[model samples]
Target: MTSTEPDARSSSTTSEGATSQPSGLPRVLSVTLTLAAVTITLLGLRQIGSFVGPVFLGLNLMLVAAPLFGWLVRIGMPRVVASISAVLAVYAFLVVFVLSLWWSISVLVNEIPAYASKFQELYLQLLDQLQAIGVSETMLTDQVASIDKQQIVGLATDLAKGIGDGVSIMAIVVTVLVFLSMDAIDIKRRIQLVRDAHPTVADALTRFGDGVRRYWVVTTVFGLIVAVIDVVALGIIGVPFALVWGVLSFVTNYVPNIGFVLGLVPPTLIALLDKGVASAIAVVVVYSVANFVVQAIIQPKYAGDAVGVTPTVSFLSLLLWAWVFGATGALLALPATLLLKAFLVDADPRGRWVNALIASRPGGGETPDPDVPEADEPDEDLVGVDGRADGENDSDDGSKPRG
Candidate 1:
C-alpha cells in the first residue's frame, strides 16, 4: 500500500509540472504577439504624435508639479484651491517656456544676415590660411561661395516655425492639465479601486509617477544652475541674446548625454557672427566648463540615483525615444523610459530578466533593493501615502537603498 501511495504522488507531481510548463510553441507565440503589439503601438504613436505629444507633455508637467500641489494642501489650502493653484502655476510656466523658445527663434531669424556676412569674412580668412599651406583657394572659394547662405538660414527658420506650430496645440494641453490637476487630487482613491483588482499594476504606476517627479525635480535644479551660469558668462563675454541662449540651455538639458554640446552650437555661432573667432572660442570654453561643473560634477550625484538608469541604457533610450516621438521624445526620454521600465518590466513577473539588463547605476553597479514584486503580494511593505505599494527604493543619489 505504501509503495502504491508513493507512485501515485510522484505521478501527480509530474502531471502538475506538465500543466504548469507549456510546450515551446506557446512561449514562442506569446513572444511573437508581444512584438507585434509593440510594433503596432509604435506605429500608432508616429501617426498621431501631434495630438499625443501635447497630452504626454501635459501629463509629465502635472507629475512634476505634484509636490507643489501637496505643499499647497499642507499649508491649510483646500484641495480645490491647491489643484487650481497648481494648474495655474504649470500654465504660467508653459507660457514662459513657449515664449522663450519663440523669442530665441526670432532672435536667430533677425540676425541671420549678420551671421552670413560674418561667416563670409571667416571663410575668406580660412581660405587665406589654406592657400598659405599650398591648397588651391580657387577650388575652396568656389565650394564656399557655392554654399547658399540663404538656403541655410531658410532651413533654420523653417525648423523654428515647425516648433512654433506646437503653440496651436497649447490649448489642448492646458485643458488636459486643468482636468488632470483636478483628477490628481482624487488619484489615490481611484488607485485604491484598481488595487483591489490589479495590485501589481497599481503599484507599478505609482512607482512610475514617483520616479518621474523626482527625476524632473533634480534635472530642473541642475538645468537652472547651468542656465544661469551660462547666461552670465556669455553676456560678460559679449555673446548677443544671452538670455535666449540660457533658456535654450534649460530646455535642452532634458535631452540626455549630449544636450549641453547641442546647446553650445547656436550661441557660439552667434558669437562668431557678432564678435569674432576669439569670442567664439571663449564662448565654447565657458560653456564647456559650466556644463562640466553642473552636468558632470553636481548632477551625476543627484540625477543618476533619481533616474535609476545606467548611462548606456539612458543613451540608447534617447535614440529609441527620439525615433519614436521625434524631438519631444528626446526631451522626455528619461521619464518615458522610467514609465516603460515600471510597466513592462517591474509590473510583470515574466519580465524580471529585462530589469536585470537595465536596472544599474550610471557608474555600473547593482541597483539597491531592486523592484521585484510578485502579483500575489504586490510589495505591501513599501506602501505610499496613497496606499499603493512601490517596490522601487530609488535613492536621491542611487548609492543606497531608501526605507
Candidate 2:
C-alpha cells in the first residue's frame, strides 16, 4: 500500500511540474537577459565579419552539396574519394562561373564613360524641363553641379572591386568545405552523441538542418530560373553586361523583399545610357514581368512548405540580420531565423504561442513536406535530394525529410 501511495504521489508531482509556469519576476529577468545577450552577440558578429563571413558561406555551400555527397557514398564510393570528387566538381563550376562574370564586369566598367555622357545629357534635359515648370535653373544647376560624375563613376568602380575581392575568398571557402566533407562521414556519430545527451536538442537541430537545406535548395533553383530569364530578356533589349546583371540577379534572389529592385538598378541605368529612355523602360517592364511571374507567383508555392516563415517575418528578418551581421547575415537571414525559431520557440511546449504570433497563418508556422511520406516521424536514414530513401542507417548524413 505504501509503494502504491508513493507511485501516486510521484504521478501528481510530475503533473504539477508540467503545468507550472515561471513566476513573473523570473520570466521578465530571463527575457531581459536573453535580449541583452543576443544584442551583444550580434555586435560581436558584425565586428568579426571579415573572418566569419567566408566560413558561414562555406558552411552553406557544404549544406547545399550534402545531398550529392550522401548519394555518392550510397553508391559504395569511399568517403575520401566521394568528398574530393564532390568538392572538386563544385570548385570547378564556381571557377568558371566567377571568371565569366568578372570578364563581363570588366568589359562593362571600361565602357561606363560612354554611358556617362548619355546620362549627363538626360540629366540636363530633365533639369531643363523642370526649369520650364517655374523651377529656377540656377537652383537646379547648383544641385546638378553638386552631383559629380567622376565621384559616381569612382563609387561604381569601388563597388565592383569589392565584389571581386569577396569572390576571391572562394579559395578559403572551398578549403573549409573539403574538411567539412571529410568530417561529414562521422556526422551520424556526432548526432548520436548529442541525442544521447539531450534528445530534445538533437531533435530540434535535425529539424533545423532539414528546414535550412530545403529552403536553400528551392531558393537556389528558382534563383537560377530568374537569372536565365533576365539574361535572355536583357540580351534581347541590348543591355550591356547582360550576363553580369543576370549573375547579380541570381545572388540577390536570396535576399527577400527589396532584392529585385536592387538588382534592377544597374542594367536599367546602363540601358538608359546606351539605348534611351524607351529601352530603359522596356528593361524595367521585362524584369517586372519575369520577377513577378517567377518569384511572386510560383516561388512561394514551392517555398511555402519548405520555408514556414511569413512574408512579414522574412522581410523583418532580412533587415534585422543585415543590421546584426552586415551583408553575409542578410543573405543568410532566413536560415538563421529558422535556427533561432527552432531553439527559442519550437523547442518548448510554451513555444506554440510564440510560433503562432510570428506565423503567417492562424494555425501556426511549421508546415508538413508534401514530398515526405511521414515528415512528422524522425527519419533514421539519409534521404536523397529527389525525395528517395537511401540504404544507409545514419544520422547527420545531411538527409532531408523528403523521401
Candidate 3:
C-alpha cells in the first residue's frame, strides 16, 4: 500500500475526489458541528458578558503583575506571599482613590444647593447687566427665560440620576477588581487558551497583557499632564475649587471626548456664579486652550503607538462596549480593544488593515518574505511564535534564538 496524499498543485483534485466520496459528508458535518459549538459558546458567553468583563480584567491584571510575582518567587518568597503583595499594592492605590473621591463628593454635596441658588442669582444679575449694556429688555429676558421651569427641573433631575449611575460604575469596578487580584492565574490561563497556535498564542497573550498595562501607564501620563495644566490655568484664573476641578479632570479624562467637557462644567459654572459672564468665558478659554494644547499637540507627540488601534475604531468600540457593559466598559475600552486587536482582529483576514489602523507607527503594513532556502525549518529548539518548541530543540546544540 502507498500513501497518495496530494501535493498543493493537486489539492483541487484531492478536494474534488474528497467531495465525490462519502468522506465529504462527514467532513462537512464535522465543520458544521465545530461551527455550531463555537456559536453556542459565544452566545452563552454573550449572555453573561458582564461576568466576562471582570474575568478579562483579572487576566489582564495577572499578566501585568506576573513579572513582579515571579521575581518574588525567585527570591524565595511563597506564591501566597507574592499574591498578597500584588493585591496589597493595588488595594493601597484604591484606598487613596476612595479617599479623594469621598473628599470631592463631600464638597460637591455641600455646595450643590448653594450652587443652584447662586446660579439663579447669577442669571438674574446677568439679565440686569445686559439690560444696562443697552441690550433690549425683551431680548435679555427671552434669552434667560428660554425654557419653562418644568423642563429645566426635569433636566436637573435626570442629571442627578446620571451622576448616580457614574457612582454605580465605580462600585462595580471595585468589586470586579478584587476578584481579579485574588485569582490571577485562572484568568491568565483563560486568556492563554484563546488561541490554537501554541507559541503564537502565548506570544500574543504576553503582548496582549503588556499592551493593557502599557495603556494604563500611558493614559495616566497624559491624564496628569491635562490635570496639571487645568489646575494651573484654572487656579490662575481664580476659579473656585481649582484643586477639585483638577481632580475632576484626571478622573473624567479616562472617558475621552466627553472628559474635557465634564471637567469644564463645575469650574465654568462656579465662575459664572462668582464673577459673571466674563469669568465663565475666561474659564472656557482656559479649558479649551489647555485641552487643545495638551491633547492636540503635546500629548500626541509623547504618545507613540503602543496599542494598535485606530481612533474611529476606538470611538466606536467605546460606544459599543459602553452600551453593553455601561460606563465601566467605556473606561476599560483601551484595554479591551487591545485584547480584541491582539487576539481577535489580528488573526482575521483583514489583520493587516486592522494593524495599520491601530498602529502608532507611520505604517503597520505586513512585510512579504522573500523566496529563499527553507532555513532548515528553524531549530527544533526554536520556538514558533507560540513560545513553545519541541523537546528536541532543548537537546540540540545551540541553534536557536536566545530566549
Candidate 4:
C-alpha cells in the first residue's frame, strides 16, 4: 500500500510514452493470453496455498528483521552467520513471547464461563433496581438475557478460532523465517546472475526487496514500541490478559486505519466483564491516547516519510490480500502488498501499468497516456521512488530514499 520512492534515478532508466506500434490483432491476442495465464496461475496458487502461505510468512519475517541481520554483519560476524544468528534469535524471542502471551490469556479465558454466570446475576439485580425507578424490569431483563447469550456465543467462537490458529501460525512463521533467512544468500546470488541477463527486472526485484525489508523493519519497530506502551498501560490498569492484549496491539497496529480499533475492542470488553463499565471506558481511553502518542508523535520522528500510503489504499490492500490468501493474508496484508509493489511493480511491464493506475489521483483507473516513459532499471534508489526528489537522502538514517 505504501510507496517508498527514492530520490535519484540511479540504476533506473526512465522510458517516456510507448512507441507507436499499432497492431490491434497482436494487442488482442496478448490480452487474451495474459488472461489465460492469470486464470491458470490463480488456480495453482489456491491449490498449493497451504505451502505458499508459509513461504510468504517467512519472507515477511526476513523483511521485518533484516536490519538486525545487517547490523550484526556490520559489527564482526560474516553476513551468513549474522543472518542466521539474528533470525534464530528473533524466532526464539517470538516463540517465548507468544507462548507466554497465549498461556496468560488462556488462563483468563478459562475463568470467563464462571464470570458469565456472575455477570447474569449482577444484570438481574441491576434490572430489579431499575424497576424500582419506575422502569419496566421485565423488558430490560429480557434484553439483557438476549445480549448475554449473543456475547457468550461470540466469545466462544473468537476463542476457538484463536486457539486453533495460534499454534499452526506460529510454527509456520518460525519455519518460514528459518527457510527464508537461510536461503536469502542463495536468492541474492541467483538474482545477481539474472541481473547480468535481465538487468532491468533483476534490479526491480532487488529494489523491491530492499523496500519491503525496510518497510517491515520500520513498521515492526513502531509496533513494538506501541506494544510495550500497551503492556505498561494495561498492566497498570490491572487488565486481565494484559500480555496477550499487548501482542494483539503489536500485530493489529500493522493493519492500517481500522487496526487500532480492533486492538482496543477485545480488551475493553474483557475489562467490562472483569471490573465494570468504568474500567472498560478507562481501557479505551488509555489505548487511544497511547496509540496517538506512539503513531502521531514518536513514530513520525523515526519513520520520517518512509511510507506514503493513503488510508484508503492501506485498507484496500488489507481486504484484497485477505481475500486472496484467507486468514493468514489478512494478518500479512500490508507487508505482502509492499513486497508485491516493490518487486513486481516497477520493472515488469504489468507492474508499470498497475503502478500507473494506482498513482492516479483519487479517481477510477484511468488508462494512462501510453507515451509516459518507463523507468530504466531498479536499484537501492527505488526505495524512495515516490518521494520528493532531492539529489540524495542526506539523513544519517540510511533507510531514506536517495535519487
Candidate 5:
C-alpha cells in the first residue's frame, strides 16, 4: 500500500503539472493569425505610402552619406559643420537629379511632336506589310488607329506633369534628410544606448546601415560604368538625347532585375523613331552586351555579397515593394528588404534558419566558403568594431546573440 501511495502521488503531480503548463496555438492557427496581422499592417502602410516612401528614401540617403559624415568628423570638423555638409551633399545630389530628370522629360516632350509625320509614314508602311501578309486593312486600321502621334504626345505630357508634381514629395524627402542627418551626429552614442538594452536591435540596425552603404557603393559604381557605355554607344549610333538616356540608365539601375529593360526601352524606341529599325537593333545589341556583361555577369557577385540575398529574393522584393509603395518602393526595395531581414531574421536566434533560404551563399554567411582559401588573418577592411568579421558572430557556439 505504501509503495502504491508514492506512485499514485507521482502520477497526480505529473497530471497537475501537465494541466498547468500553457499550450501553444496550433501551427495552422498561428500562421493564419500572423498572416492576418501582416495583411492589416501592410494595408495601413499603403495608406500612408506617400509619406513613408520619402521618409525611407531620406533614411537610405543618410546611410549612404554616413561614412562621409564620420570621416569629416574624424578629421577635426565640427559636428554641426560636418552634419550640414553631409546634408548639403545629399541635397545637392538630389537637386542635380531632379533637374536632369526635368530637362530630359522636357526635351522628350518637345521632340516627340517632330516625329508625327515619320510616325504616319511608318504606320502606313506597317499597314501595307500587314496587308501583304493577309491581315485586313480595315481590321488593322480599326485595331491600331487609336495608337497615334497625338496619343504619344499626350503620354509624354502626362509624364512631364507627373515629374512636376513630384516636387512636393522631393521637398518632404529633403526635410527628412536634414533632420536625420542632424540626429546622425550622435548616432553612435544613441546606438550604444540601444545596445545597452536591446543588443540585438542595435546589431540589426548596424548591419542594415552597413549593408545599405555597401549596396549603394557597388550599385553606383556599376551604374556609372553602364551609363557611360550606353551614352557612348548611343552617341555613336546617332541616337538623339543619348545623354538623357544615360542619366535614365543611371537612375533606373537602382531598380533590380528589370531595371535594364526599363532603361533599354526608351533609347530603343527613340532610335526606332529617329533613325530606323536597323538603328534600333544596333541600340538593343549594344545595350544588351554592355548591360549583360557588367550588370549581370559582374555586378551580381559584388551585389549579392553586399546585400547577402539571393537573386530570387531581390527580384521578389522588387515586386513586393513596388506593390506596397509604388515606383519609389521599387527604387528602395533592396534597402527595405535588408532592414526587414536584419530585424526579423538576423536579430532572432530561432529565425536564423530563414537565412539558409534567403542568403546568397551556403550556410547563411555563417560558414566560410570551402572554395575560397582561408586568410591567415582577417583583412582589416572586413573587420568590425567588435573584432569580428562584419557578419560573423563572436562565439562558435552559434548561441551568441546576433542581429
Candidate 6:
C-alpha cells in the first residue's frame, strides 16, 4: 500500500508541474504578435507624419513655454491673458527662427553663383592631384563629370525652395500651438485627474515633461555657448556667413550626437571654394576643437543627467525617431523617446525593469525587487512644491514648513 501511494504522489506532482508551466508556443506567438503590432503602429505614424510632426512640435513648444505661462498666472494675470501671452511668445520665437533660416538660405543662394569660377578651379586642381596620386584621369572624369557650377547652384536653390515649402507646416504648428497653449492653463488639474485614475501613468507623464524641459534648457544653453564660440572662430578664420553658420550650429544642436557635422559642412565647403584647402583645414580644425569640447564631451554629461538617459540611448533614439518621423523627428527624438518610455515602460509596473538598461544614473527609474527587502527610499526625481523629496522634512513631526 505504501509503495502504491508513493507512485501515485510522484505522478500527481509531475502532472501539476506540466500544467503550471506554460508551453513555449504561446510565448512565441505572443512575441510575434507584439512585434507585428509595433511595426504596424510605426508605419501608421509614418504615414501621417506630416500632420503628426507639426502637432508634436506644437506640444513640445507648449511644454517649453509652460514656465512662462505659470509665471504669468502667479503674478495675477488673468488666465486668458496669460495663455495669449504664452502663445504669442512661442509665435515670436517661431517667426524669428523661420526668418533666420530664410535669410541664411537667401544669402547662400546669392553667394553660390559667384563661386562658379572658383568651384571649377578647385575641381580641376582636385582632379590633377588625384591623377598625380596614380588615379586615372579618364576614370575620375567619367565618374564625376556631371558635378559642376550649375549643379552646385541648383542644390542651393533647391534647399531654399524646400525651406519655403515648409511654410504650410509652420502654419499647422502655429494653429496647434494656439490650442495647446489655451489647454495648458489647466494642466495641473488634468494631471491630477490622470493621477487619480492611473498614478503610474501620471508620474510617467510628469517625468516626461520635466525631462523635456531640462533637456531643452541644457541643450539651448550649451548651443548658445557653442554658437558664440563658432561664430567668433569662423569670423577670425575668414569664413563667410559666420552668423548664419552660428545659427545653423545652434539649430542643429537640438539634434544629438551628429548635429555638429551638419553645421560644419557648409562653412568648410565655402572656406574651400572661397579661400583654399588651407582655409578649409582651418575651418575643420576650429570646429573639431570647439564643437568636440562643448557639444560632444561636456554637453552630453549634463544633458544625460538632465534627461535621465544614457548617451547611447540618446543616439539610438535620434536614429529611430528620425527614421520614424523625418527631420522633425530628428529634432524631437529625445522628447519622443521620453514619451514612449512613459507609456510603454513607466506606466506599467511590470515593465519598469527596462529602465535599468536605459537610465543615465545608477538606480534611476528602477523598482525594488520583490524578493529582496530594501529601505523605503524616496525618489530624488519626485519633489514637492517646496523642492524637498516627498515625505521628507527637517521637522520632527515630518510636516512641511509653511511658506
Tens-digit per-residue lDDT, 1-403, candidate 4: 1333442232132322223445355767877887687667646766776567667776766655665665564465565787688688778767765665455457656767868876897687777788888778767667777786778989999889866765676678777777777665334345445654565666555545564665566777889888898888888888887888888888777554567886888788788888787888899998888889877566544342233234445557667767666666766665566555554454555435564444322122222232353343322232222111224232322333435
- lDDT tens digits by residue: candidate 5, 1-403: 9999999999999999999875688657966997798788778878898889879988988877776776776576766787788889998888777676567667777888899998898888888888898897888667677678898899999889766646756888988987887786656555655665666666666767778888889989999999999999999999998999999889777654566886898888889899988999999999999988998778766776788888778777778888888877877888888888877776665455677778887563632333342332211111012222234333421233557
lDDT string, candidate 2, 1-403, tens digits: 9889989999999889876956455777878987898888778878887667667767667666767776776677766776677777768767765665556456667778776777789988887888789888788778889998999999999899866756655666877877877766656555556555555556566667677788888888999999999999999999878888998888768554567876788788889888888999999999899899998777765664575677667767778877766666777777778777767755554444565556545363463222222232233322223212355544334332333
User: Which candidate, 4 or 6, has the higher TM-score?
Assistant: 6
Q: RMSD per prediction, one decimal? A: 7.8, 6.6, 8.4, 11.9, 8.2, 7.9
Error of 3 at 41 (Å): 10
Q: Candidate 6 — which pairs collide?
A: none
lDDT of 5: 0.75
**What are the Cα lDDT values of the candidates?**
0.72, 0.70, 0.60, 0.62, 0.75, 0.74
Best by lDDT: 5
Q: Which digits, one per residue and each the tens of the lDDT, describe model 1 over residues 187-236?
A: 55556556666767776776677767777789889999999999999989
Choose the strongest candidate by TM-score: 1
Where does candidate 4 stray beyond 4 Å? 1-19, 22-40, 74-76, 103-121, 129-162, 221-248, 251-275, 285-311, 342-344, 349-353, 359-403
> Model 3, 1-403: lDDT tens per residue?
1344446538878778888776334756866886687567656655776666555554555555556654564465654666668666665765666676567656666777777878777777776888788887687668778878998999999999877865654566567656655555233333334322343444444556656666667778888888898888878888778899888778767655576776788788778777677889998997888788876565444433445454555566667666555555666666776665555544343233445445655243221111211122221111111122233232233333344
Using Cα atoms with residue i matched to residue i, what is each candidate's TM-score against the true structure? 0.72, 0.71, 0.64, 0.63, 0.72, 0.71
- Runs of candidate 2 with Cα error greater than 4 angstroms are 1-25, 106-172, 228-248, 251-266, 273-275, 288-305, 347-353, 359-403
**In model 4, what lDDT does residue 292 have?**
90
Model with the higher lDDT, candidate 1 or 4? 1
Winner by lDDT between candidate 2 and candidate 1: 1
Question: Could you give the candidate ranking by lDDT, starting with the highest?
Answer: 5, 6, 1, 2, 4, 3
Where does candidate 1 clash, by residue pair?
none
